[model samples]
Target: MGERVLIALGGNAMTAADGSASPDDQRRAVEGAMRHVTALITAGHQVTLTHGNGPQVGNLLLKNQIAADVVPPVPLDWCGAQTQATIGALVLNALEGRAAVVVTRTLVDPGDPAFQDPVKPIGRYFTEEQAGHFEKLGQTWRRFDRGWRRVVASPEPLEILDAPAVEALVAAGFTVVAAGGGGVPVARDDAGRLVGVEAVIDKDLAAAMLARAVNATVLVIATDVPQAVVGFGTADARPIGSITAAELRVLQAAGHFAGGSMGPKVEAVLRFVEQGGDRAVITSLEDIGAAVNGAAGTVVHR
Candidate 1:
């Protein structure tokens, strides 16, 4: 039997060098990602796929805002859920019998500290005038380049609502994609009914929760970069190949990773290792197989 692996794909899995958001562009990107996934399947690994949707979700939000006059714009959470289903469906179709996507949801605590500070960014970039208009409407906005965008809170995932379903699908010999865009950021009410919230969940954190729930032996995170680097872009920069969970924690405490970038990836791997995962790999989509086989990328262990 193949080892069960959960692969968390980053934004570059969909975005290209030109930063186009068209369907053709994204499909091309996924073709490259699928090659890596197919290689893993051929190498005898039962894979469960998860992906970040920062670029896609931002495009969705922008479209929603532009069409709001003709159609009621969906809330952020609902838009997120819709993107999960959209991207997942396309990926499943592309897999052509290799994998199936489960439009999954994850549960969050209603009182997570993140709710007090909405910081996860979303939507297309806007000019200063456009940002000023949104500010007048009471939307939280931030500047990127000379433009601006709205941001939201990203809380920790408490549970994966569709983990059982995903496990069953894997047992039936199918690759599964779940928890896209951090599983739609929903929380349960007092009556136990699931309700969507106005927040996003970090994809890496959600991947960790899903990895734990499914008991995946390996957790591989595919990013644009091949390896995690320290001191990022200076003469002292170093590429990390392997490290213990303890060493990762110390580096994190020393602020070696940026919060909006590599920090969450390292943090998620540490959590997975600490919670009994055998190994974790951080690599780009093209190097996924090599990373798993220990020839490339950074590996983290307990």
Candidate 2:
């Protein structure tokens, strides 16, 4: 029998490891990723896709900075919405026009504590001196292993506003793509109006929420790695296979995952499984089909 599957793609799905960002490169990447998706579809699973937009949005922000004098820079929410359209288009086209793309919106709390502590990194990297200058100008910047970059608030996604549209499309037998870049983070105003907010929400977390909203039986988080590892850097490092959600949570609390990378993915999977999802899998995009069947990747279940 077919299952409703929600696949959350990591940023690498839209770009190459070679750092190629040209239009052709992006299309080619999406085409490559969609091959796996099509395989699942052919096998009878109803699949919906969501992807990260870090690199694409960062490039847009860089362009805004370089062309600031001639043109007014676009806001963060706008940049996110743009990527949703752009990447969603690529995914739809790659599926040979068989899918629907929803320019979705996610509701967040304006009072989310993440706003007070900006920690989600975005845009181009800067040197220590450059970061210092930006800090003095009241911008939040953080240094990563790569370099210093501007950090923005990443709020929790309370609701996927367009989830009904997604469900409708799926019920009509359409492969749906929604919630790119966490659905353009929005919050309600005093008058109960939905307004875009200058914030980013974690794509994996949003994917889990969407999966639950649509009553999806499986959530697949596709990343660059074939599977998540414990003791990731050392000799004892080993890939995690099928495990109960309770066991995974213990490892997460033991600090096996890094906050920036695998941590969010693990958290997202745990949330889905603990909150009524039958199971969730974390795997590389290339092995998504096998992962879905419990033949590959790190499978987590209740």
Candidate 3:
């Protein structure tokens, strides 16, 4: 029997290093990644997909800024929603319309501590002077390996608002594409109305929550690396094959993973396992087939 699997697609798999992927480019890239997904479906695993939107949303943000004089700029949440449609279309097409793209929304707490301390970076890199200019305009910018980029509050996801829709689709035997860009982070108002917020929710964390919501047995996070590593970017770096949640937690606490990059991924893997998921795999797209079969990648268990 096949297990229900939730795969979180990394932004690196869709966009280029410099973050300039046109729709045609993204379509080609998504098609390449979907071949792996197609293989999984062929093997009988029911699949649900979620994807990161940092690059896509960033491109939209840049466009908004460049044309600010001609048009009003869209909010962060709107940008997120737009990418959900854009990428969702690409994935849906690659699946030959055999899948459903749910325009999902993620419920978040308005008071999440992350709001006060924005750290999730998005958009294209800017020079020190350009970053300073944006800072003066009230946007926060942070220095990263590439350059300074815009950072937004990354609140923890409380629930996936459209998870039921995704579940129904999957239960009906449809491969579901959902929670794109963490489902456009939203919160409830005093009147219990859904209100979009100016924040980005970490897609991996959201995927874990969605996995638990939909009762998925397997969670796969596809990234640039074949497996999670300790001492990353160092000569002493090592690839972690199979690790228990407790052991991975120790390495995480010791700061082997950088908060900006691999930390959230490892955290998501632990979150899924500790929260009752049977297993989770962190692997690259090239190895997804083997990873699902337990022949490759870092497998995490309780």
Candidate 4:
């Protein structure tokens, strides 16, 4: 039987690690992902897609810096909106005009703690001296295994404004792509109008919000791993299959997942299932079909 599935494509889905992240490269990557998506559609399922634009948005920030003297840099929210359209175009191209993309805006709390303390790492890595250079310009930097890098706020997604449009598209049997880069983080002013913020929202968290808003039964978080694993990169690393939400939370609290990556995926899935979702699966794009059937990936249930 067909089902409604909301798919969250990880950052790696749009760009290859080895290949140059050119427009051509992105189109090729999207085409391959679309093949997997089309497979689900052909089997009579309704699909909606959301993607992370970390790398692409970072590239835009870099370009803005390079041409700042000649052109005013774009705001973070605007950069996010621009990437949504650009990535959407690439996805639409891959879909061969069969899908529709909605440029969405997400609401966040104006007093969200994330804004008070930005912790989302972004852009390319930098050496200590380079970090110092950025620090002089009032940019926040943090040390990592590679080097220092800029960090920004990853606010919680309160609502996805265009979610109805996405759901309507899926209802009409068309695949819809929305919530690119967390839907250009925004908040309501005292006057109750939408105002763009200068920060990036976590894509996984935003995906969960979209899933909830659209009332999707299954939330599929597609990434580079076929299944969520514990002791990742260690000799005793183990794959997680089906697990209850409570068990997953215990595992997460034990420090089993890294904050920047897998941690958010686990958090997203937990939020979905806890909030009445039937199930949420985390797996690689190639294993999507199997994941939906409970034959692959790590499934989190109520």
lDDT of 1: 0.84
> Against the hidden reference, what TM-scores do the models get?
0.94, 0.94, 0.93, 0.93
Model 3's number of clashes is 0
lDDT of 4 at 141: 84
- lDDT per residue for candidate 4 within 1-302, as digits (tens), equals 88888999987789875645788788888889889988988887788999999878889988876676588767789989999999999888887746899999998998999988988888888798877866676667899999988887878888988888888887777788999988988898999988998778888999999998887889999999899998899999999999999999999999999988899999999999999999999999999988877778999998
RMSD of 3: 2.1
List the pairs of residues colliding in candidate 4.
none
* Leading candidate by lDDT: 2
- Which rank order by lDDT, best down to worst? 2, 3, 4, 1
- Please give the CA lDDT of all the candidate structures: 0.84, 0.91, 0.88, 0.88
Worst 10 residues of 2 by lDDT: 130-139
For model 1, residues 1-302, the per-residue Cα lDDT tens digits are: 66789999988887776778688888888777888898889889888999988788888778876775578667788877878887887787768775778888888899899888887777778887877766675578888775787877788888899999988888899899999978977888889898988888888988988998888998998898998988887899899988898987887898889998999999888999999999898888888887776677889987
lDDT of 3: 0.88
Tens digit of lDDT per residue, candidate 3, span 46-137? 89999988778878989976776588768889998889998988888888947989989999998899989988777888899888876776
Shift in Å, residue 279, candidate 1: 0.5
For each of the candidates, the C-alpha root-mean-square deviation to the true structure, in angstroms, is: 1.8, 1.9, 2.1, 2.0
Writing each residue's lDDT as its tens digit, candidate 2 over 189-264 gives 9999988888999999999999999889999999999999999999999999999999999999999999989999
Q: What are the runs in model 1 whose C-alpha is more than 4 Å off?
A: 132-138, 143-145
Q: Tell me which of candidates 2 and 3 scores higher on TM-score.
A: 2
